[model samples]
Target: MVDELEKAKPIIIKRVKRKGHDFHGGSWKVAFADFATAMMAFFLLLWLMGNTSEDEKQAISGYFHDPSGFQEKAGSSPAVIGEGGANVAVIEIETIQPETDDIESEISKNEASNKPLSEEELAKLAEQKEIEKLKQLKKELEFLVENSIDFSQFREQVMIDITPSGLRIQIVDKDKRPMFDSGSAEPKYYSKTILRGLANVLKQVPNKLSVTGHTDATPYVERENYGNWELSADRANAARRELLFGGIKEKKIARVEGFSSSILFDQQNPHNPVNRRIAIIVLKRSVAENIEKQVLGVE
Candidate 1:
């Protein structure tokens, strides 16, 4: 029976079965994607080269070479074009020089029309400059006294202003806090600190200085020829010596005058404590010249 079954199956089971090929491998898709990417990169490069301005191109080139944008030495360098692979080219471009004929002609015309200032005009200009400088000095002194820790406490006592002569810095006396001992030219401890600071600032300026001393109108008995005038004069000279010791040049001192109660700080109250003060005047060069001329009777 087994032999008969085998023979029958062998004769009948001759059917054909067809199978489709595996998905044509996906490798072809990968190759197509790579081709598209390369084409996109090529087009982008073309757009950049065509549209970029000269300065933009130069800046990009500089960034590539030095990402940190720091130079070893400060100097001018020649501009560069794209310097790589396909666009590598050493272009030596010359800068366009601006025409200066019009400028030169304008300058020449101005020179021809200009006239030298007369003596009076020159003097007026000098006075204007001096006034401006004095104003600046006054502002600086005010700032120093107002801001400094050591000097700020004396802000009320220190007065800085621009005068007709030049800048005037005054350290006036308060009833309770006198800069000097009563009827004495000796400076208090705080007064020395202020003077030293002032000397340091005064040394920076080229202007000559004048120190004046004033006294209150209270009467004092003359003893051994020592009176208000001598006391005021001695005090002014004493302040001058302190300034010199604190580094102020002796040559910068133009004058030291003592007006014993003659110039009252408060005209209404002759015996006001504010009248007893030390006055430091920064004299402008022009003002000093005027004073000199007056002294010599040359004006």
Candidate 2:
């Protein structure tokens, strides 16, 4: 009975020893390896954060949180490189700032330098200059007509308006003194004197000038052969000829338009005496340039 008991005890001890050898716990080694790997990752993150911009760092932080639009690319390790020349890990920099600030600086400079004048400001300046020039011309015309006719009446008939295009000097016709002899294209003696004075003033200015003739809607009874169009055109041409005679260069005359009653002062009252008139249009250089381009076939 003692010998059987001893044999069973030895067998049980041998089994226990075998079991201990087979199931040797490795939890300490696994914990040590995990600690080492975490330390390496921590250092790598620190190094990458040092190299990346603020925007890029924020992007990477966002990617880790959601990874919705993040894509992994094959590249160099943001950490230490392996001796075998294979990249084991990578750090992505998503938002890189532009390096050249010159473009931004140049845009700022251009904005500062090339500011344009407002429409109101431009209009005010043009009107002021035009008014000054017209006042000077008015004085000269008053002096010229002092001998023959009452200059005060002429002043009331003539008016100068500054427009976006340029200065427009209008000679309005009335019952007392019509600019043209009733339906005829011929200028009255006083009207010729006034036109010569206008030409003399125009010759001093450097702007391009245009002569236009306008007539009231009253039909001609005596000169039925020459309609309003022909009379208007002839009157404009006569004024142009007088301007040339008064020392104005023939080339400076831009155009002569005969607007027979189409552009009346008062369309409802077509027989208004003011509708029968002559207009001297002074064009600015900018306006002349646009006209010149059209004439030369330039786009």
Candidate 3:
């Protein structure tokens, strides 16, 4: 009975099925590959642009601007020159040219006309050029004075201005900062430094130069036969020598003069310190020409 009961006992078996994670799509991989390919093409395009010649670049630009214009004007012809077949033979090709060349040619034609300019017109042209050069020189000097620490300290004393005569550069004296020794023509060290620096700049312009010296109304009787007039003249000459030392040609100097308290900068105060100064003028072309003609005894 026991054996029959054991054999009749029920037996059970269970099985669990576990599902895997969801499958992610491959869209991002395709997008990333496309981005990488685009970057590579972009770099290749940049390299090509960097290596292309100006003419090739222009040709490419023209083709893009008007693709139809790049087509060759042609007619149907035989491929072997005897039998007629559907064939296009390019006879001519038109190219795009820059518009600036046309404008330049027009200007050149106008300027290179047969008729010569009158003397007055020539003078006006020369004057215009002289004015331009002087203005540029003035600008350079002003920039130097403003930006350079060496020149900034004496900015007030180093006065520069444009006048009808031409560019006028004045190195004037302060109350205690005289450019020269009192009652003497000897230039102070800093004064020589200033003159040499100015000379290097003045050498760039083709115009003739005029250097002048002036003194205040205070009378000087320190040396025999040496008054303000002689002192001023000597000072002017000394400045000229320094200019020559700084690489300016001697022929560039048109005149050296001295005015003893005659043209006081501050008219109200005759003895003002500012009256003592060195004035260097870059003469205009017309004036220089007139000077040359006069020296040559031409009417």
Off by over 4 Å in 1: 1-112, 294-299
What lDDT tens digits, residue by residue, belong to model 3 across residues 1-299?
99999999997778898875444567777888999999999999999999974434544554455544433421241111111121111111111112345444544665799655566755565566557667777766775565333454677889888887778999999988899979778888888877876776677666788899999999998788888999889888989999998778999998898998889999999999999999998888667677778889997
Worst 10 residues of 1 by lDDT: 85-94
With candidate 3 superimposed using the best TM-score fit, by how many Å does residue 267's alpha carbon deviate from the native? 0.9
Better of 2 and 3 by lDDT: 3
Tell me the spans in candidate 2 whose CA falls farther than 4 Å from its real position.
1-150, 221-225
Candidate 2 per-residue lDDT, tens place, 1-299, comes to 99888878844344444345533678877888999999999999899988975434444555555443333322232321222222212222211112224334544565688855466755555545554554454444443343223243586678776666666788889878898888777888778867876675577666788899988898765665778888888899988888888778988888888988878977889999999999887776556667779789997
**Cα RMSD for candidates in order:** 21.2, 31.3, 20.4
Cα TM-score of candidate 3: 0.61
Question: Distance from true position, residue 259, model 2, in Å?
Answer: 0.7
Model 1 Cα lDDT, one tens digit per residue, 183-216? 7889988888788778866777778889988888
Worst 10 residues of 2 by lDDT: 88-97
